[model samples]
Every structure is written in C-alpha cells, then in structure tokens.
Target: MNKIIFFAQTRELVGVDKLELAVDQMAISQLLEQLSLRGNKWSLALKEKTVLCAVNQTLVNYDYIIQEDDEIAFFPPVTGG
Candidate 1:
C-alpha cells in the first residue's frame, strides 16, 4: 500500500489528514487526478490550487513516479515574511 498525507491548508480544505491507496505504481499527477474525482470538495482542494508534494520525505514534482509502499505528502505552498 502507498501512504498519502495532507498538510496545512490542503488538509483543511480536503478534510482529510491522511489515507492509503493500494497502488503499485503511478505518476503523482495521476494520483492527484484520481483523488480529485472523489467529489467536488476534493476537486477544489486538489485541482484548484498549486500544491507541493513530497515522496518518501523527499520533495518531488507531479511527474514523479510513485512506487508501492511509498509515502506521498501534499501541502499548499508555504508563504510568510
């Protein structure tokens, strides 16, 4: 199974802190697209804004390939003075 985690505003917007998926391998974009299909709230939270991503604690781009047992995290861009 692959672990998916949400942080900060993305977590608040999605109403979910974390989840697990039985995916063997897929692109981060594909995973995001799948999550967006869950409902309107999911779509808005995942597709309407720029979300940063990390795979196995390492930052990665949407094109990054996710493997089984990988841990993926999504969070909104951080901004502060």
Candidate 2:
C-alpha cells in the first residue's frame, strides 16, 4: 500500500491527514486521477487545485512513478507570515 498525506487546507478539505491505498504500478498523475474519482470533494480538492506533491520526502513532478512503500504528500505552496 502507498501512503498519501494531505497538509494545511488540503487536510481540512479532505477531512483526513493520511490514507493508505492499494494500487498497481502507476504514475503520480494516474494516482491523482484515481483519487479524484472517489467523490466530488476529492475530485475538487485533487483535480481542481494546483497543489504540490512530494514522494519519499523528495519533491517530484506529476509523472513520478509511485511504488509500494512510498510516501506521498500534497500541499499548496507555503507562504511566510
């Protein structure tokens, strides 16, 4: 299972900080697409927002391949106070 984490507003919108998904070999874009299909909120949060993604604590693009045991995090760009 791959781990997915949501941060900041993403977390509040999704109502969860983390979730585990069982998936086959696929790219991050594909995973986002799959997650978007879960519901309107999920679709809007994932598909309609310009959020950033990281894999295994390393920033990556949407094309990055997600592997088993990988940790994925999503959040919007950070701003200073």
Backbone clashes in candidate 1 total 0
lDDT values of the candidates? Answer: 0.86, 0.82
- Give the best candidate by lDDT: 1
User: Which ranges of candidate 2 are over 4 A from the true structure?
Assistant: none
User: Which 10 consecutive residues of model 1 have the lowest summed lDDT?
Assistant: 40-49
TM-score of each: 0.89, 0.87
Clash pairs, model 1 backbone: none
What does the lDDT come to for candidate 1? 0.86
For 1-81, candidate 1 gives per-residue lDDT tens digits of 988999988899889999988765788888889999888878777873488889999889888888889999998887879
List pairs with backbone clashes in candidate 2.
Answer: none
